[model samples]
Target: MMNLISNAFLVVRPLEKRNKLIDEYNLIIEGLRSKGINIIELTSKEHLLSTKYLCSGHWISSLGKGVVVVYPMSSLGRQQERNDLVFDLLGRKGFKINDVVDFTEAENEGFFLEGTGSIVLDRLNCVAYVSVSKCSDEELFVEFCEELEFTPVIFRSSYSDGLEVLHTSRILTVTESFSIVASCMVKDKKERKMLSLQLKKSGRDLIYISEQQVENYVTDIKQVKNDKGDSFVVMSKSIFDSLYTDQKNTLGKHGEFLVFDCREIERQGKHSIGSILNDIFS
Candidate 1:
């Protein structure tokens, strides 16, 4: 229950994009390393095929004790080859990965999970909040949840125009003591109430954010602890700035803020700091 991650994976953005992002990337690495987190930098030969947001937490979800589940990207090309390169890199770094589900198989069947992005995991409570989207297949999600013995709290989230939320992590952040959620994004009253009651039942305070806050990446935050058991909440500077004083105060009760400048990363990649840092549970 320490909720401390010993390692994390970060992909080197494409060469053309790295020029503007190297400084921020290094800063993030320095920030995480300072907190006793080992950083695994992924630099592949097939960097071109790497999605702009490939380094995000969405690509892989760790099931603790060195097990991981990698999801297939719906529209991304050469996903298997890219994943092979990544797995090889991880293997060389001494990570004995036991994939619960094969990405290739899922891709062949046109099912995609998008890893942690599609699901907000309350690991301590053994619950997972999943919002159905193109990146998350309902059947695949249920099967994966069953494999891990996690109760799947499935819900639907879409905009007025019927545009689905691409990732659950974008609208919900489940920390140890509390959850930052954009309940407004979930239009269904029953599902919204279900999400609310579930969080409360888990003994977590719900800090609901507006749709505008979600657009500012307010939910893209994560809580982690260092070797000494010092807890910190990691987030982008933009998200930290966007928070109101009361929200900051509420979140501060749980952990100290560990903010970094990732505006370019967010702008170019369309993901926040939470997305870029995938917790390595091994």
Candidate 2:
């Protein structure tokens, strides 16, 4: 599989405190386009409800080819944010609607899986790792794995006080050459080892991050490509600052990178690069 995405899908929905984010949003879009990456902006609906961060487009993910999987979201705001417009736009863009695994109905059963935010997909290796939380349902995860033919690794990740992390990307991130993970995310020693072994078996070098870094949103990143075919990981200045010099060197060995000055965005939306952008076609 060609894992590099040449085109990106970004949503324009603002958070409840969005008056200050318009500039940040435009700069991010301009930066991505400047790198020769195609940008598809999804316009927000007319709903006036206060959505804290529905702009992430977390209710669906493109499963390569024309296949798109609509997920079950915990937030009613996000569920409502998954409008039909994205699908219509994709259809017009010639993305074949091969099949859609509509897990949206699972919300009635109290099971929620918020697309890529609740799970990290190693598409090339066909492996998915989900940190069990209110937003990530194990049964639905199993169903997703079966439909996509992936090995599912489900585990619990929490903070020092036992509050579970809401998003899998907060602690576990998969890049093309390495996996940046928080060992503490897997509370059980044996389970952590098993997860690490699985990644090693799948051929990814491991880079362990500290709990402090995870708390600062360092894992919230994504691997992207430039027009010249060079690979780079997009991150925030906070993510870059949270890392040690040596850790940065090791991560740089995998790919070049771009860091955005997004302190205000993080303060307003509590999200970084990976959270704001989604890829529709590459």
Candidate 3:
């Protein structure tokens, strides 16, 4: 679980102030840590920015039980950001990573699959939702599904203006009990219908959002439980505002909202609140 956001960001260079992003990221980290979310912040002097829509911190995933999946990024420069040193940092932080599944080899074949950005894993239901894009490839996606034994639900997230969504996390988010997705995230009606039906059949309540909210990153929230078993849905202030009253009401039915104003990072990083959170399961 390495955090690379508080330092490096490749978007909005004009209005971006490193100090502001640092302050906001620190605040978010403190808030989550208070709620018993174990986090490790990896520091690097290089101003490396990986993918345009993908969070640098989200370039890899802690797949629980000492296994991690390192992604094959489209940016060659970003690939250099993660190396032996990064893994060593995680090891020092008590992330017992005994095995690493490297997906970077696909870069030679011109196929790339970003971690978490390419696929949204419904861990409990054994399902995965992926948006087809340059950042996500079907071949690499199927390999990941087979490795995890998750049923893959393929869809193309296209906006009304004829733009395909780049990151799956931007369009949908799933938790243990529910999922929030933008109706316009998937352009294929049949695929969308299948996803909706599958989610419902799997016993998850759906909180559907609009394309506008998806652009605002409202659905990229993360649900976590405190040591006392209190549940919270963590999100940025902007995302919170983007939600409809009924949507907030629906979330309230499931968990408390941990909202903070992270406009600076959200704008420049193009990421939501949970974007920086890296979970290393015990």
Q: Ten consecutive residues with minimal summed lDDT in candidate 3?
A: 4-13
Model 3: runs farther than 4 Å from truth?
A: 1-17, 49-57
Ranking of all candidate structures by their TM-score, best first: 2, 1, 3
Of the two candidates 2 and 3, the one with more favorable lDDT, higher being better, is: 2
lDDT (10s digit) by residue, model 3, range 1-282: 222112111111211336787677677777767776555655643556542332544467766667778888877775665545657776776667778888889989988887777788777667788888988898899998898677898888888899888778888887767788886667778988977887778677799888888878887787766656677888888888888888888888777889988887677767776665555553
| Clashes per candidate (backbone, < 3 Å) | 1, 0, 0
Clashes of 3: 0
lDDT (tens digit, per residue) of candidate 1 on 120-223: 78888788889998888898889878877888999988765779997888789887777998888899999999988898888887798988788888887877
Residue 178 lDDT in model 2?
75
What TM-score, over all chains together, does every model reach?
Answer: 0.89, 0.92, 0.88
Q: What does each candidate score in C-alpha RMSD?
A: 2.5, 2.2, 4.9
Looking at candidate 1, what is the lDDT of residue 13? 44
Query: How many angstroms is residue 47 displaced in model 2 relative to the true structure, after the best TM-score fit?
Result: 4.1
lDDT values for all models:
0.75, 0.76, 0.71
Residue runs of model 1 more than 4 Å from their true location after superposition: 1-17, 45-51, 78-81, 91-94, 98-100
Under the 3 Å rule for N, CA and C atoms, how many clashes does model 2 have?
0
